[model samples]
Target: MKLIFEKSVPGRCCALLPACDVPVRPLESRFARKDPPRLPELSEVDLSRHYTALAGRVHGVNDGFYPLGSCTMKYNPALHEELAALPGFAGVHPLQPQHTVQGCLEVLARAEALLCEVTGMEQMTFQPAAGAHGELTGLLLIKAYHRDRGDAARTKIIVPDSAHGTNPASASMAGFEVVNIPSAPDGCVDLEALRAAVGPDTAGLMLTNPNTLGLFDRNILQITRIVHEAGGLNYYDGANLNAVMGVARPGDMGFDVVHLNLHKTFSTPHGGGGPGSGAVGAGALLAPFLPAPRAAAAGGGYAFETPPKSIGTVKAFYGNFLVVVRALAYILTLGGDGLSEASENAVLNANYLKALLAPYAPPACAGVCMHEFVVTLERLKKETGVTALDVAKAMLDCGIHPPTMYFPLIVHEALMFEPTETESKETLDWAAAQITGILRRAAEDPQSLHAAPCTTPVGRPDEVAAARAPKLRYRFDTL
Candidate 1:
């Protein structure tokens, strides 16, 4: 394949425009550039075919089964896209007067309300743009809530060993000491250890129910109780909320702060960086510290209100408003019962796949899982010299995107899979069969797995060289 620029022909145009009808002013001499900009030139057909071919080569949830763990890469409903693209919704400006954009404001309010009802929180701030940003916003709220009460001494946040790396990083950015509590052998947080770790210095605990291991913390009630007993707040990392949506409420479980990844559990697109929304919800205790301006009802309509003691604008103009619109569309489409069914089916698919792969996996503590599960390849590595990386590469050959490998850090040779709710049983079975077949082949000819992914456009580059000599920016000199 050649670079798009390499195929460019001089003076070729993809589009034609009529002469300007309106009177135009001359450019300011100071603002004018001395040289013309370098750009690719191609015919309309050339440009169209090039991009269309590129699109075909990329795989997405719409293209196939994406069982990538932690990241909920599920099929986004096409209706949401259509709704988001509507001119009435899409043309509205963020800085437009409140009266001019009441419908858009109402969508944000409704989305916030739906999230509050689903998570059992009092109010929500849809200002955070991504999951990590949401964590920072939640932590800031915790800090503000404590500081407003003159409890500035609360400066430490307790995170678990198996937590997403963002948890600790967010805490650190908020000027809190991050204390890590280890997970027990059974993969739940070490209750006794957490109890000992908490004290007056503890600001809060960041936890994910149905943790990264895809195992729900059986001691959740007790865990929250322990944190609250020490006068510290509980922050729910709602990344895995899909496993327990209507069945459980983080606020009811004693979580003081929560952030829901709308793109994950709520049927929006994921991956490729994003246009993502991570709405932060808070219980009554933390509500006053939410970011402003919060959407409110006024004069038979909606308006923005900055609370007296708000953390103050975590994002510009109520975060990504378009993503919020998509989430609102999703919530309205699913309602309550449909959302519950999604959670149920997500758990069912995960457990079914776990059962299918159990015999081939490295030793795991016996039990039922939630929406995702980890299967270690330690034994396979020891027996056949093949590794988790090899298996992931082999999965590509079978036309399936690989599960996240070597994550959660605790599990050796981990292959974490989250099939999500949308995949059919036939697809799950095929994935399982492919994984099993790869393992069997590994036992016989380990070398074959070394040179895997022969079908892809590029196979097995020298990763270190690629990284060390990254071609980050385009250069005409190089061309």
Candidate 2:
């Protein structure tokens, strides 16, 4: 494809402006430019066609099956986009008087209510911008709660070894020392190790139920009880909440604080550092420390009200109101029953793939998984010297996005797959078949696996050079 600038005509214009009506200052006195700005000069038709072609080259959930594990790239309803784009919802200003934007506040309030109902929490604060940001905010709330109760010495947070990296990073950012507890052979938190880790200095334990390996911690109730007995809180990282949405509630599990990724669980468009909403919910104990200004009933309408001791503003305004609107639409579309069915289907699809791939590459543990599953390529690596990276590259040639590789940091040759609820049974079967074929091919012809993605617009580059000497901006000279 030609660069847009390369198609530029010297004097072409997309629009014609009328003569300036206001008195204008002399150019020498008012402006400091020696030459006019250089911009693309293409016809409207030319510009439209160029962008349309570019959009077609991109891959998304709408394009095909996206089985990127731990990322839950599920299909979003088109109604969400249509509803979020409505002028009344999208055109409102954050600083508008509360009375003027009652409808917007009502939408936010309803979102909070729905989140509270879904997660089984007392209150929610839609202040964090993303999942990590929500983690930070939730940790800060924990810090404040401890300090207020005169437990300043409780400054240690325990995280499992298989947890997402953000858990420890967020804990560290909140001024707590992070202690990693290893998972047992069964892929769940080691109860004995956890008991040893918890003490007077422990403030909380951050955990995901169906951990990154997609194995549910069956002892979650006992784990929460142990933490509480030690005078510590349990923080639920809702990254994998899609696995247990309607089946379980964090609050019922004795979690004091939780953060839900609206994009992942509620079907919102999220990628490339987002346009995401991560609403933090709190049990009654932590409710008083939620971020301000929380939505409250005022007269006959909703309005913002700050708690007595909040964590202050995590975002400039109500965080990502449009994203919240989209989430609300999704919730309304998928009532409680539909959401449960989605979770069940997600688990069913994952287990189906697990069964198909077990003979080829089984997980570290046994039994059924939750919403996603991980398979290792250790045998293929030992026999053919072809690694999981080679298999991932080979997937692109088969016209499918690769599953997440080398993740969870638990398995050696991990290929994490999450066929979300949106995928069909045929799609799941085809994906498993392709993966099996790739492994078989790798055994026969290892070199083909190493040199893969032969059918992309551009082949792979030298990864080291691409990272260290990145060409972020276009250069006319290079063209």
Candidate 3:
């Protein structure tokens, strides 16, 4: 595919501008720039065709089955998008007077209330923009709570070894030393290790209920209890909340602070570095320290109110508002029972996929997985020199997006799969077949697997160079 700039014609224009109807001010005087911006020049038809071609090359949930684990690349409901796009919701400015944006405030309040009911948290702040942002906000809340009580020694945050990479990163960002406790043989938090890790210096424990490996900790209650017993708060990372939405509540499990990924679990189009809302919910203990401008019911309408001891605005305004709007629409559409059923189906679909892949890529942990499961290709690499990356690349030839590769850090050659509730049984069966065929190729013809993804426009890109020395912007010299 040619770069848009390479297709540029020197004198071509895509659109015509009406002759200036008012006195024109020089843009150069307002904003300083050394040279005119170099943008592609093309006819409208040429530009349209260029973008259409690019669109065909891109793949998404709408394109086909997306089983990216932990990320939850499930099919989002179209109705949610339609509702969020409503002019009243989409056009309302964050800086608009609270009285004028009653409808917007209502959306926020209603969304917060629904999320509170689902997670069993007392209060919620839609201030954090993404899951990691929410983690940071939750940590700040914990810090404020502890500091207000004159508990200055609390400085360390305990995280499980199988936890998301963001868990430790968020803790460290919040100025808390991270203490990693290894997972037990059963792929759950090691009870004794957790007990030993928490002490006077422990500020909190950051955990994902169904961990990155997709194993739900049976000792979740005891895990939170141990942390609380040692005077540390428990922070729930809602990355895997798709498995237990409406089935379980983190607040009931003794967590003091919880952050939910509205983009992941809720019906929001996410991924590819996009708009995510990680609304933080808290128990009564940390409610006072929540982000400012919290939505509250005032008389018949809704209004924004700051908590008495607010953290003073984690975000400039209320969080990715449209994302929250979409999430609210999703919750309203599903209702309570439908949400539970969605979670159940998500778990069932994952287990079914795991069963099919067990022959080639054995699961990292034994027994039932939640909405996602991790499979290891270590044996395949040893036997056929076909690593997980080879398998992932081969998936493109099958016209399917690959599962998350080499993640959770603990598992070797990890390929995490999450076949969300949206996929049908037939789709799951087809994906299983494709994966099985890829594994067969791995064993029978390893060299062919190395030269994988022949069907894609770019075959086997230099991934290491792409990551380490990215060529993000197009340059005339490169072409």
lDDT of 3 by residue, 5-69 (tens): 99999999955888789998777665778787889889999988998998888898999988988
Q: In candidate 3, residue 339 scores what lDDT?
A: 94
For 315-345, candidate 1 gives per-residue lDDT tens digits of: 7888988788888888888889988888899
User: What's the TM for model 2?
Assistant: 0.94
Name the weakest run of 10 consecutive residues (lDDT summed) in model 1. 359-368
* lDDT, model 3, position 457: 82
**CA deviation > 4 Å runs, candidate 1:** 16-18
Error of 3 at 413 (Å): 1.5
Flag the better candidate by TM-score, 1 or 3. 1
- How much is the lDDT of residue 151 in candidate 1? 96
State residue 38's C-alpha deviation in candidate 1, in Å: 2.2
Clashing pairs in 2: none
All-Cα superposition RMSD per candidate: 1.6, 2.4, 1.8
